[model samples]
Target chain A: MDDFKFPYFFNYPPYFTLQPVRDTREKQIQLWKELILKYCKHHKVFLINLEEEFPLFSNTSIDRRLTYESREVFLGALVSEGRAEWMDKGHKKCLILWRRIQDWADLILEFVHEYGLEEGVTTLEEIRTGDETQGTELAGIDRVVLVKALKLLEQRGKAAIFKGTSADDEGVKFSI
Target chain B: MRRRPGISGLQTAAATRDQYRSLGENVAKIRTDLMMEQLSIFRSQLEEFARKHKNDIRKSPAFRAQFHSMCAKIGVDPLASNKGFWAELLGIGDFYYELGVQIVNVCLSTRPHNGGLIDLEELRGLLSKQRRSSRDPITDDDCLRAISKLKALGSGFEVFSVGNRKLVRSVPTELNKDHNQILEIAQARGYVTSEEVQVSLMWHSGRVIDTLETLMKEGLAMVDDGHPDGIRRFWFPCVGSTSGAVEAGSELSS
Candidate 1:
């Protein structure tokens, strides 16, 4: 696994604990939110499970682990900003939309136009793991998020999806 | 014979009055002159004493504070000007002025992070860092005096106490009675829960939460939910010694 380069303050133990000072805590939360988004975007991390240990939530170099409450609060802040969503009612897992669905849809449309995939029939798996997506941000994309983006495009009449012979295989036909 | 005697007696009485008046005026003149001479002597002696202990007075905060009180008793204002016998000889005024400038620097530099409100001890620690090489030590009293001088800038610098700690506020936010009362209650234990605030302040829960929320909004207070009692404790950093609390927090986490 590639090591994510944490910011200088990441090593500071106090950063893991939620500050009690109102102004200090707000700044701390804002920094945490930014770092989380940047890290998720870089690593293409789609979900963060609070019940399970998340690497970003702890810094082994400093031996600081964020308390569960702090984790929930920080994630709660992201959810409120619409940048993230709770996957379950318990908020045990969070879907990190580092790039919002709307933005992702636009990226997909750009990819389609760039690659001349506009009138081409391609499997959903190919779009995610095909040579065309190789080295692109769409490579290794989460199927759930990819489906949601494709559905958005399908709603706009820019694309269509049909099930392939295998239940796990699906194909998309882009009209644009 | 009676008239002649009465006339002589009146003349004698007038002479006696004149003699006594002259005598009284002479005594008053000598006493005034003597007092003036003694004051000059006392002034020079004080100057000599200040000159001899200049380093002690400057290096030791307790000594400096004592010197200030002594000067106060004698109706002397050593900090009256940056240039004078006291300023030139002892330079105490310049010391405080330099401290005031450094305080402004620290407060301004940390203002973004602290929202223009800093704990007094924290400010002192930073100030000491700036003057680490200097022989003079900065104390809470020194910081208070320096901040008091910063008030001349009209930049809204002021020192106020909350609980047992002092906080320097560079903003003009007025803390009302409710805010002050809440801070006062938090001083006893470094924190106050909503129930504690309600019971001690004789206020409704709504009022207690409302004021605490306002304080939290202003970044003057912080909430802690680590307690097992399920009661959220609102901590006032400005009211409690931050170093002590930081140590306690680290200990708990460790």
Candidate 2:
């Protein structure tokens, strides 16, 4: 994460503020959207809690931080673009979809094909934290997001999700 | 002088006045014709000079500026017509025209950031960057000439000075003296608080806020309210680090 480089404008003081003019605000929002996505992806962060400290939203050197309104505005822009989603009605927490659900579903399918798991039945937890998924994008995956991706795969009739022997365990069978 | 008492004497006096008037008209016409001939000769010689050193004028900024000055002294606009000898021989007309178009593109591209106002030196840098494929290097003088030519299109393309910096304004919004003063104050640190402006400019808070708001509305200034002091800071990109270069060493090390 130390190798992650922020944009040059990240240090600019005014970048922390929400622009008032239409054109300027539009560009500002665009830059913020890009920075948010890149930052989350770099840190492997899937959630942004607006109430908590987000390092990208502040520059201590310049003594500037994005006000709550500006933070919400920028995150709201991402939500409207389908790059993120608000987790609560108050918009305090946001689920960052750095990679869209469709792409994640595709990656999951690719992973299954790479591991020759097309015909094998595996539990949902195994795909997420199993040894075969180590050092891969699927490691430490968010359950809800993974479920949504799996549901998308199921919709295409490529996979089946069903209960295992115990009520707590869920298994997925990939048809190909 | 004797007074004329009859119609014959009056007629002679009137004829003499008419003769003098005709002589003056003839002299004036001949003088104009001589000037036109001299001007035509100067034009041909200039054309010959341009044709001979066409590469120098195109390649060197200094030589190009000198050539433009000389043309100005003789009252010949080499960039007036795009189809004539000047354009055909030197392509100076097209040069500035191309520069003008590039200027507009640069301004438009940076407008989202700088709000249609840019430092002239930065503009030249961007223009040269955009013109990197061409052999010619443009000067500030060339930019001024091209921008002056752009004034004909009536889109508020003009250069003005604030403090020691020359700023090119592409927007039609006019900046009054107060706005200029605020900009000058902001130039030192890129951001100015209303209290500072009020103290330095000896202006009331109302005037300061009004002017700053105008700048904000015009996208010339952005406001920061996150400072520990809790005072609003107005940041002017046109006068600030918009043209700042990234320190390569620090970046590489980091």
Candidate 3:
């Protein structure tokens, strides 16, 4: 992973702790949410497991770390905003949708149009790892997120997903 | 001989008028001189009294407040200028000016954490720490006066009350009426519930929530979800001392 540059406030110790003041905490939470999205987008980080140490959630320079409860609260806020999702019933892992699903679906369509892939058949794996997607944001995209974005397009009848002979492989046929 | 008598009578009358005019002028001059002497005496006595109580004025908050009131009555403002006799004799002007600078420094340094708002007592504690070498005791009133001088800097420095506690705001953020009312309601226990605001302020739940949400967005309030009753409690850090809030938190947990 490349070095993730933090915003100036990332070094502030209090930013790591949950503020008890409603107004201050709200501002703190807003800043936290923005920083998290920016960091995730920059590093292509899709999942934040609360049980594990996330570099953005802890500032070693100030020796301050967000408590588990604060982590949940911040992630919960993101979930409510539709910018993230709980990966399981335990709510320990978060799927950060820095780009909303709708936007992701649009991006996929744009990519298809840009590459003249309309009415073309491609495996889900190829869409994410294919040489054609090498320099695009679709490269290295999380499989779960890609599937969800594809399903959204499928719901609209713009694309179709079919299970391949192996469970690990899936193919998407874009009709648009 | 008759003509000479008439001229003498006229001369006597003129002399009498001149004498009365001189007498009146003499009385007025005497009164003016006496008043000047009395005023000089009073000013000198004030200077002597100030000299005797210089330490008291600096060390005791009560004495300093009294001194300020006396100065007000006499129209003598020691803080009016940082030069001349008052500044030289008392150094009060420079004292507050120095304090104002230190306040700005503390506010700037803590802005990233508190968002330009700090509890007045906390500020005093920090200021006293900064001025520990001087051994000059400071008080809330002193801080108030010092902060007042800082208003001239146009830095939006002002002292405001949240509940009973005072907070110093270094930034120009406006706290609307709804925010102040919520803060005032939270003063008793350092925290307030939305239900409490609704009941006490007679505000609808939506209004209460809207106001509280705004306060939270501004970083002036904290939400506590640990209550067993499950009612979210909003805590105001600016409404009370940190230690006091900690104690209150412990009490709630217990």
lDDT of 3 by residue, A1-176 (tens): 55555654554334555776665667788888998898899989999999999988876654557779989999999999999999999999999999889988998999999888899988988988999889898899888899999999999999999999898898999998
Residue-level lDDT of model 2, residues A1-176, one tens digit each, is: 36777675676678887777787789899999998999888888898899999888887766778989999999999999999999999999999999999999998998999989888789889978999889999887787778889999999998999999998688999997
State the iRMSD of every prediction, in order shown.
8.6, 3.2, 12.9
lDDT of 3 by residue, B1-254 (tens): 45666788999999999999999999999999999999999989988998999888877879999999999898887887788677888887888898888989988876655667788988898788778897678888888998988887787998888666788998787998888898888778767999899998899999998898777777666666544465667866565454343344344334
Off by over 4 Å in 1: A1-26, A31-51, A55-176, B1-43, B106-122, B162-165, B225-228, B245-254
TM-score of 1: 0.56
DockQ of all candidate complexes: 0.10, 0.41, 0.07
Q: Pick the candidate with the highest TM-score.
A: 2
The RMSD of every model to the true structure, in order and in angstroms, is 9.2, 3.9, 12.1
Give per-residue CA lDDT, model 1, range B1-254, as digits (tens): 35555788989999999999999999999999999999999989998999999999988889988988898898987887778889899888888898888988987876544456787888888777778986578789888877877887798998887666677998787888899899888778667889988888899989988898888778767666545465677766555554444344454335
Q: Rank the candidates by DockQ, best first.
A: 2, 1, 3
Best-to-worst ranking by TM-score: 2, 1, 3
Lowest-sum lDDT 10-residue window in model 1 chain B = B244-253
lDDT tens readout by residue for model 1, A1-176: 35555654464445566886666787879979998999898888998999998888876654667899899999999999999989899989998889988888998988898889889888989989999989888898888889989999999999999999999999999998
